[model samples]
Target: MTDVRSDDRPTESLRDRIATELGRARDRSVRLTEAVDDDDLVRQHSPIMSPLVWDLAHIGNQEELWLLRDVGGRTPVRQDIDELYDAFKHPRKDRPALPLLGPTEARRYVGTVRDKVFDLLDGVRFEGRRLVTDGFAFGMIAQHEQQHDETMLATHQLRAGPPVLSAPPPPPSVRPVGAEVLVPAGRFTMGTSTDPWALDNERPGHPVDLPAYVIDAAPVTNAAYLAFVDDGGYADPRWWSGPGWQHRSSAGLTAPMHWRRDGTGWGCTRFGRYAPLVPDEPVVHVGYHEAEAYAAWAGKRLPTEAEWEKAARWDPVSGRSRRYPWGDEDPTPEHANLGQRHLAPAPVGAYPAGASPLGVHQLIGDVWEWTASPFLGYPGFAAFPYREYSEVFFGSDYRVLRGGSFGTDPVACRGTFRNWDLPIRRQIFSGFRCARDARPDETA
Candidate 1:
C-alpha cells in the first residue's frame, strides 16, 4: 500500500490531497446539517451548545479567515458578520438572539468563500509564505471543519426528534475476553514532534518516566458500570470526592445521562429512540466525576494522561512512539469505529487490529476516555496562530480526555490529540476505563 505520509509527493499531488480532505470535511458537515430542518438548525438544543446554524456559518468564517485572508492575502468578503461568528466574543446561549444569517444566507456565504478559496489555490505557490509553505493553512482549516462537524453531530443527538441520521452497524468483534495489561516502568516520548499538522498542545515531544502500571485491555463496559450502580455506587458517598458528591447529589444522577429504568430493566435513548442498554458495549455519555466514582468503587483509578499515551503509542522493543496504536497507518472500517459510521460504540474487546503493542484494545476509537490528569501543556509549549485554541483552557479546572470517539473524523483524530471539558459535563461522547498500579515485586 502507498504511504500518503511520504513528503516526496509532487506539488500537484499535494494540492489535490488538500482539496480532497477539505471536500470530505465539508460534505460530512453538510450531511449532518441536512438531517435537521431550518427550525432545528435555529433552535438551541442545550445552553452549552450553539444552534446548528451558528456552527455551519462559523466553520465557513474560520475557513475564510485562515485560508482566504491569512494565507491567500484576500480581502474580507463579509466583514460585518465577523463578530457574530467570533466564538470568544459570543457564548452559545446568546447566539440565537443575534442578528444571525438564515440557513439560506449561511449556505450562500460559505459557498462564496469556498469558490474564492479554490480560485486562489489554482495559481498559488507552495514555498514562499510560512502559512502556505507546506499547505499548513489548508490542513488547519480542514481539521477545524471536521472538528465542528463532530460537534454538529452531537447537537443532532441532543435535539428532540425521530432519528434523522442512520448508518449500518459496525461488523461484530470476535476478540477473546480481555484482561489487564501491564506496562513496564520506563522512559517514553509522550507527544508529537514531527507531525506537521499537529496542534500546539502536542508539540516539542518530551520524555516522561513512569512507574509500572496495569490498565484494562478494553474500556469499561455498560455491563460493568451496571454492576457499580447495582451496588449503590451512586447512593454511597464513600466512593466520591467532596465536590463530586455534591454535584451528583444536586443533579440526582442515578445512571448515565439519557438512561432510565424501564419497568424492571434499563433502557437508554440514542438519537431519539430508546432501546435496551447493550450490556457488552462500552458505556458513553459519562461525566469525569461519575467515571472517578466508578473507578473508586472498582478499587482502581483513572490513568494519568501520560500513562494513557504511553500505553497507546509506546513500543517497548522499538523504544519509540508510533503515530497510532496500529502503527502509522490511517484508520479504516476494519480497524476502528469513527466518522459517525455508527451511532453507538462497538462491543468492548472489539477492533483487535487497532490494539496497542502491549495488547490494549479500543485505545484509538470508541469513546473519549477520561484521564486522571488536568488539562495542562507540556514543557516548552507555545501557542500558535492564537491562544484561544488551547492555552486559555490550560488549568486544573478542565480535565483531559484522550482517544477519539465514534463521532470524531479521522482528519481530526490522532494518538496525541488532546480534548478537554469541564469535569461536570455529561453531554459529550465520553467514557472511562480503570487502571491500577503494579506491585513493586511484580514484573511484566
Candidate 2:
C-alpha cells in the first residue's frame, strides 16, 4: 500500500482531492450531530431513523472497515462494536436499544480513526487493486458519510422540538420557466461507465431508447400541489392507484407530511418550525404514492427513470450525455441548491444556469424526483466489492428516485445517481414532476 510510482503528480492530485472531500464530509457530520443536545442525539427521533449518535459512530466504523482495515491493512480500532454498528444486523427501529456509545466517546473514536486514515493517505498506492484504484475506496467512504449526513438532516426535520438548523434561503426565480419542456424522441445513455466514483448500480452505461415525452420544466411546486389538495384529491379514488389509495387511507395522509390547515391557506412545519407554505418552492417530503396521485390528478404520469435521465443528462445537440444538467462540469452555487446550501427547495426556475440543453430547469437538485420505475440493475450489471450496496436492494418492492435534494451533497448527488425507498415513505426529502406522452405535433 505504501508503494508510490515514479511520476507522482497524478497520485498527489488524487490524494489531495480525497483528503479535501473526506474533510468536507466529516465537517458536515460534526455540525449536524453537534447542533442538538446529547439526549436528543441519543434519542430516536423517528423509528425509521437511527439515533444521531448511532449514525455518528457508524460513519466512523464504515471508514475504518473500508479505508483503514481493507485498504490500508490496519487493525480495527473498535472491533468489539463491529456488530453494533452493522446496519443490516440491526434495523433503525431497534438501534436505540443497543449499547450505543455516548456522544463524547463517539466523537473521540471517530477523531482517532480519522487521524489514522490521514496517515495512511500520505503514502498509499492508488493502483494494483480495484478497491484502491483511482482512490475509489476513499471516494466510497466519503460518499457514504455524506449520505448519512443527509439522513441526519432528515432526522432533524422529524424532531419535535424547535428548529436547530438554519441556512440562507435559496435564490429567487430570475427566469420564467414554462410549465413543461418537450424531449424529442431518441436514444440517450442512461447510466455511467466512466464516472470514477459511481457505485455498482449506475455502472456499464447503456443506451435507452425512449419515445417523445414532455416533462415538467422544474419539479412540481407547493402551489401546484396545493391545487390538488383544494380539489379534494385525497378523497377521490380515481387519482390514486389501488395500493396507493390503500396506503393513503391507512396512513391518513392528506396534504404533504408536516402540512396543516392554516385558515384558508396551508402551513408546513419545516425543522420543527411552523410557517406558511412557500408557494413557488418545489413540494417536498411527499412519497411516491402522493406524487403519483398528483400526476394522475393533473392528467399526467410520472416519468420513467430513463425519461428523467434523458431530460437531465442528454445533450440534444451533441448526441451524448453530460454529467449534469448544465454540462460535464461539477456543480457550483449558481447551478443548484445542494449540500444544504438552503434549508428547503428553491423556487421553481430558481437556477436558470442549471437548466438542461433542452431548457428543462432544476433537473439536478432541490428535491429528489420520483420515477415510474423499480430499483433494478442495468443490462450488464455486476456487483463490485460488495453486493449490499445496491445489488441486494434490487426488486419490485422499492421504487427509484432520481435527482438529488437540497440536503444532498454533490459527491453523492449526480445525474445518474440512483436513490430508492418504499413507496409509502414520507420522511425523506422526495418530490416529483409530472410527465406525459408528447402530442403528435409536439413530437415532430
Q: Best TM-score goes to which candidate?
A: 2
Q: Write the per-residue lDDT of candidate 1 for residues 337-358, one digit (tens) a residue.
A: 8888998899976788899889
Please give, for residues 1-444, the per-residue lDDT of candidate 2 as tens digits. Answer: 357577987888899999999999999999999899999999998999999999999999999999999999998999998999999999999999999999999999999999999999998999999999999999999999999999999999998887789888889989889998999998999899999999989998999999899999989999999999999999999999999999999988888998999898899999878899999999999999999999999999999999999999999888999999999899999999899988999998789999999999988879999999999999999999799999999999999999999999999989999999999998999999999999999965
Off by over 4 Å in 1: 1-9
Model 2 lDDT, residue 284, Cα: 95
Residue 365 displacement in candidate 2 (angstroms) = 1.3
User: After superposing candidate 2, which stretches have Cα over 4 Å from the reference?
Assistant: 1-6
> How large an RMSD does model 1 have?
2.7
Candidate RMSDs in Å, in order, are: 2.7, 1.9
